[model samples]
Target: MTQSTPSAQRRSNLKHRAILDAAAQAVAQQGYAAVTIEGVAALAGVGKQTIYRWWSSKAALLVEVYSDLVSRQALTPRSNGSLEQRLTGLLSALFRLYRSSSAGAILTGLIGEASRDEQVRAVLAEGLVVGRADIVTALVQAADASLNAQAVNEVVIAVVWQRLVLQPDSLDEAFAQHLAALALAAGRLS
Candidate 1:
């Protein structure tokens, strides 16, 4: 069997990253509905087949886009600080990521699509929501071994969802700190 050469692999990786980055930019600027395979291909300077070879549909492409963004941006628990401090940091980072950039627009677009598409919802929930929840759960447990990780995760996600979907204007550093305090208090009660 023949293997892909190192140069070939590098080129492939570059192309893949280019497409994802272009898609993100497109979504950020024009929104999901405005993005297309041909548009992304043109933006990435590739053939339409290149995108189709990797993704079956625009929604699938968007799932990958959000997945990549989430993997890069999601914060984890830090052992160097108290749980409240670390949690607050995580929340603040999330708020900033979602507030100040195209990441929020990408997420909002994907979320709106997820409402009508089961596959999109699954991918978004697994790759974005559950992944972040897992990180928060660990932080909650680290903060207090006796805390209910599941409940804490639920509360954390609820607050984030409220800010992301229901009330985007509510996200801020102060809110993050307050949310962390509430989570900590809830953990103690549980």
Candidate 2:
């Protein structure tokens, strides 16, 4: 493999971050229906070919955008808290994130698009479901070694997704606490 010069690498990294940010902004402002590769290219001040050179499709770009956004912006659960507290902290962070950031719109768009697009659905299944589930599963195992990780993860995902998609209005600290308590109780039983 050819090595990239430090300057060239920096430039490429800047461009990549710009494209992801632009894609996120496009989705947030225009909704997923209107987020075209062309639109993202224009917003990022890059050529359409530049985007295509890096990502195979808009769905692929969106997956990267979601991952980058979550890594950079999503809140981390406290390491010191009780299992209930840690889970509550994590869910609350997610709720606050979805409520306050472009991530919310992007998530809604992904979910909506998944209904009709197999590519988007696959991306969601891998990125959102598995990614979020892994985090919760680890937290559940930490909380109670006897608890069923997969089952608890499913419950956590279900509760969060319901708040995100079905009842966004109810995504609050109280809801986060309730969801955490419910998950902990059910997890301990199983």
Candidate 3:
């Protein structure tokens, strides 16, 4: 088989980027349930086969899209603030993202899909759950070396998931503070 030339590689990369961007835009605008491979292909000006070559299902594509969104948003905590302040800031940013953007809708839809699809469930766990838990664990450990990172991570994830699913409208600054405090308290207790 012949190797791909540099120009051909660049074209492929461009198409891949376009597909991802189009997927993100479609999900954000139309929501996950409404988005389709055909629609994303039309938006990206690529054939559906191109997306199929990269992702086997919509859930897989969405997992990558949400991961990209998190990376672009820079939701991690900064080092300058105190532990409480940093945690609060991080939670607040997440809340704002969930409230004002497509992240919330995308995540909600993914969670629902995860229940029925084993592949989606595994991908979501590895990409979303583990990644966010690692961030929270790092922040907790950085703040208090003796604290139980796992405990804090669990509390943070639980609170965030609960609010995102049950009381999304309540995910504001005040709730952020409450969650931060609860995480710290749980860490201390653990």
Q: Report residue 18 deviation for candidate 1 (angstroms).
A: 0.3
Mind giving the per-residue lDDT tens digits that candidate 2 earns over 6-107?
999999899998999899889878887789999999999999999999998887788778777777765667898788888888888877777666777777
lDDT of 1 at 151: 77
lDDT of 2: 0.82
Q: What is the C-alpha RMSD of each candidate to the true structure, in Å?
A: 2.2, 1.7, 1.7
Angstrom error of the Cα, residue 74, model 2: value is 4.7
Query: lDDT by residue for model 3 over 72-152, one digit each (tens)?
Result: 889989788789899999989888887766788788888878889899898889878886677888888877998988998
Q: Which of 1 and 2 is the better model by lDDT?
A: 2
Off by over 4 Å in 2: none
Candidate 1 lDDT, tens digit per residue, 82-103?
8889989988887887766667
TM-score of 1: 0.87
Q: Candidate 1 regions off by >4 Å?
A: 188-190
Model 3 Cα displacement at 179 (Å)? 0.6
Give candidate 3's TM-score.
Answer: 0.91
My TM-score estimates for the predictions, one after another, are 0.87, 0.91, 0.91
Model 2, position 102: C-alpha lDDT score: 72
Local distance difference test, each candidate: 0.81, 0.82, 0.86
For candidate 3, which ten residues in a row score worst on lDDT?
A: 97-106
